[model samples]
Target: MTVETIDLDAAGVRALNRRLQGRDGPVAGGHFIVTNAKGRHALAVGLTEAMDVRIRGHVGYYCAGMNREADVTVEGNAGTGVAENLMSGTVRVTGDTSQSAGASGRGGLLVIEGSASARCGITMKGIDIVVGGSIGHMSAFMAQAGRLVVCGDAGAYLGDSIYEAEIFVRGRVESLGADCVEKDMGERAADGLQTLLERAGVAADAREFRRYGSARQLYNFRVDNAAAY
Candidate 1:
C-alpha cells in the first residue's frame, strides 16, 4: 500500500494535525508516514480516525495523546506522557518512554517495548499498558480501571491507592502500595494474560506473572481502613 509522507518539523506536524481537525477532522484516513520527528513534542495529538501512522524517530511529550482508532507505531524512544489520556487506538513504542506514560487513559492499548519511567500508567482508566521491561516508582497510582502488565522489575510504591485495576508483574516487586495485595491467577485470568501478551507482541510465559489488585478493604471510607489512607 502506498502511504503519504509528512516530512515536517515540529510546528508543521502540529499544523497538519490542526488542519486535519478543523471540521470533524481531516479525512487523511489512509496510511501515513511521519519522518524527521527529531524528538519534537505532540507530533500526533487528538487524532480521531482510523489511520495508521508510523513515526521514524524519537518524539517528545504527548506524541499520541488522546488518540482514537488510529494505530501509531514509533520507531524510537518517546518523551514524557506518551499516549496520555488516550481514549482509543494503539500506540507502540519501540524504545523506552519517559514518565507518566499513558496517564489517565480511558481506553486503548499502549505498548512499551522497553522500560517506562516514573508514574507509568498513573490513574489509568480502562486502558491497557504492556511494558516489555521495567517501570519506575509509583506506577498505577489511583488506577480506577484497565490493566498494567510489566515484564520486568517494578520500582517502589506500585499501585498506591489503586482501585480495581489489575496488575500483572513477571518480576519481583520492590514494594506494594496501600491496599494492594497479591491474588491468585485463575484459569480465566491466565488466558487473558496470554491474550494481552499476544496483543503486545511480547513473548513471556503467563505463569511467570502474578496478579494484583485492590484489597477492597479501602473500597469504602471505614475507620478501620484508615491505615490504608
Candidate 2:
C-alpha cells in the first residue's frame, strides 16, 4: 500500500483533506502519517473512503469527525469531540480524550486506550466504544443503541437517561443514572463482553466486568417514574 506523510505546518488541515478527497493521491486507499499534528483541530473530518491513518501527536477538537470507513490511530491525546458522529470504521486513541468523545455516532467502533472526559457517547445511535481507563461523569447519556465497554472506572450518573445501550465496566461505578441500573451478567452477556474486549484489544477478562442497562421503568414516564427523572 502507498504511504503518504503530511506535515501540518507545511500543509493546512483543509489542504490535506482536499488531497485525500481527490482519491488520486496516496491517501485514496493507502496509509497516511500525520506529522507535527500539534493539536490541529478537525484534522481528518468528513472522510468517506477507507484508509489507514496515524496521527503522531495530539489533536484538537473534532478530529476525525464524521468519518466513514477509515481506521484512524491517534498516538497522543485527543481533544473534545473526537470521532463525533462517526458513520463507520474504527478510531483509536492511545491517550486520553476530552469531553463528548464519540457523541452521536451512528456506527463503527471507537477505542480509547486511555481515560475519557465527561459526556462521552452522549446520544449515541449505534456505536461501540471501548475505554481502557476511567471515564468521566454522565457517560452514555441518552444512548440509543450499541455497546460501551469500560475497562476502568466510571464517574457519577453513568448512563443517565439511557435507552438501549449496554455498558460494561470492570471498575467501580460512582453511581447510576435515571432508569439505569445494574444487570445480572449471564453467560451470554459475558460472551458478548468478551467479544467486544477482544475487538478493542483489551486483555481484561469479561467476567470481571459488570453490566448496566435501562431499567425500563422510565420509558412511559408514569407519575411514579417522575422521581426517576
Candidate 3:
C-alpha cells in the first residue's frame, strides 16, 4: 500500500480530511500513517472498520476518538483521552500520556509506555489499559469492568467509586477510595498483568505490582455520602 503523508497545520489537516471523505478510498478499512503531527486535536475521529493508523508525533487531544476496530499507535505523547470510547482493536502510545487516557472506553487495549496523569481509564468498560509508569490521583474512578496495570505508584483516591474493574499498581498508593480495599494477589491477577506487560512489550514482573479495585460500596448513591453524590 502506498502510504500518503499529509503535512498540514491544524486548518490544513481538517481540509485534507474533508477532501479524503470525497475520494473513493476506503476511509474505514484503509491504513493511514500520519506524521509531522504537532499536537493537533481531533486527529482521527469516528473512524470505523479494521484499519491501521500509525501517528509519528505528539497529538493534542482526542486522538483516535471513538475508534472501532482500528489499530492506532502513537509514537509520542498523547494529550488526553487518547482512546476514548474505543470499541475494539488497540491503541498504543510509545511515550507519556496526559489525563483521562482511555476514558469511558468499551473494548480494546490501550498501552502507555510512560506515565499517565489523573483519572486514567475513568469509567471504562471491558477495555484493558497498561501503563509502564505511575498514575495520578483518582485513577480508574468509577470504572465498570476491565483491567488497569500500572507499573509504578498510584496517587490518592485510587479507584474511587469503581465497579468490577481490576487495578494493579507496582508501587505505593496514597489512598484507596470508599469501601475499596486491598485484595490478595492471586494467580489470575498475576497472569493477567503478565500478559498485559508482554502485550505492551513492557519488561517487568507482574508480582512486583499491588492490586486495587472497587468495593462496590459507592456503586449506588447514598444520602450519607451526599457530598460525593
* Clashes by residue pair, model 2: none
Model 1, range 38-87, lDDT digits (tens) per residue?
A: 88888788888888888999999998999988889999999999999989
lDDT of 3 by residue, 125-166 (tens): 989999888899888888889888988888889888888888
Off by over 4 Å in 1: 19-28, 219-229
**Candidate 1, clashing residue pairs?**
20-26
The RMSD of every model to the true structure, in order and in angstroms, is 3.0, 3.1, 3.6
Best by TM-score: 2
List the candidates' TM-scores in order. Answer: 0.92, 0.93, 0.87
lDDT of 2 by residue, 25-51 (tens): 545577889899899899888888888
Candidate number with the higher lDDT (1 or 3): 1
Ranking by lDDT: 2, 1, 3
Our model 3 lands, by Cα RMSD against the true structure, at 3.6
**lDDT scores for all predictions?**
0.90, 0.90, 0.82
List candidate 3 segments past 4 Å from native: 15-24, 27-29, 219-229
* Of 2 and 3, the candidate ranking higher by TM-score: 2
